[model samples]
Target: MNTNTTIKDIQIISLPRIEDRRGNLSVIEKEVLPYEMKRVYYLYDVPGGAERGGHSHIDQQEFLIALSGSFEVVLNDGEQETTVSLNIPNKGLLIPKGIWRELKNFSSGAVCLVIASDVYLEEDYIRDFDHFIKSKNS
Candidate 1:
């Protein structure tokens, strides 16, 4: 974990929204993120009252968008915490590495689109809170 990083480092990035008579479209280009996107995935069909993402990344950064419904992202930085609600399709939450995060309070039919800075690696995740805290202190 990066001790210098805190909850204050979390950012909400807005994408370009082009409105048309038929519908609206949002685009995410190379310049939209601090890191190059190497992977993409989404979460859907989440049951009510359930949660996801109870871990912290070692070096991976991610941008999450609520493409359909709404959800709350609870972020914790060893000593501080914050919660961000994502509900707009054109807006996203940019989460840097070293911050602990959990996704919860998802509305029915919610879709979470995630653009990752790197491919998935099991060793890159700190799955335990105690371990994450220790890494932050180290």
Candidate 2:
């Protein structure tokens, strides 16, 4: 796995939205994303001021979107950190492997949609901050 990644590597993608008189529609194709999506999941009904996602992946990548409402994503690359806000349905954040992420500051009734590059695996996750730093140094 490549450990020489930084928070700058993260990408914000703007999806195409088709507006009409009835309703608006947004489309996401496989080619538009940075990786081929293998898993799809969503986070909803989070209590106010709650947080989620506090780990880094070894071989998985993810794309996160705010389906409704808004929230913040805090990203850390063992050295530097930054926060990104997701409020628009047509905008998505692409998070590559080796970066630790934390989701926080969710508004009421917010829905977070996530698309992953790989299936879930326990061994691929770095749950400890010390371990993540060590991995990046090594």
Candidate 3:
């Protein structure tokens, strides 16, 4: 884990929006993200007041967008914490490594789209908060 990482490293990235008579379209090309995207996934059907994501990544970085409805992401960087809301399709939250994140307050029909820098690797995740803090401080 990166010990120097903080909440300020998180960024709000805006995708290019092309408007047309029919509807607006957003694009995510190679230059959009800091790293090359290797995997993509989405989360949906979360019951009201239910929460997701209680872990911090050791190496993987992720970009999360609210494709539908809305949700709040609570981020902690061992010394400080903040909450960000995602309710737009063309905007995304870019989360770097070594920060703990929790997704909550999901409205009905909310869909969270995640674009990741790496594939699913269980060894890359630090799931416990105490262990996460220890790793960050060490």
lDDT of 2 by residue, 1-138 (tens): 448889989999999999999988999999998789899999999998789999999989999999999999999999999999999999999999999999999999999999999999999999998899889988
Candidate 1 error regions (>4 Å): none
lDDT of 3 by residue, 82-125 (tens): 99999999999999999999999999999999999999999999
What is the C-alpha local distance difference test score of each model?
0.96, 0.94, 0.96
Distance (Å) between predicted and true CA of 116, model 2?
0.0
Q: For candidate 1, give the lDDT.
A: 0.96
The 10 consecutive residues of candidate 1 with the worst lDDT sum are: 1-10
User: In candidate 3, residue 90 scores what lDDT?
Assistant: 100
Q: Give each prediction's root-mean-square deviation over alpha carbons.
A: 0.7, 0.9, 0.7
Q: Which ten residues in a row have the lowest lDDT in candidate 2?
A: 1-10
lDDT of 1 by residue, 1-138 (tens): 555788989999999999999999999999999999999999999999999999999999999999999999999999999999999999999999999999999999999999999999999999999999999999
Among all windows of ten consecutive residues in candidate 3, which has the lowest summed lDDT? 1-10
Which residue pairs show collisions in model 3?
none
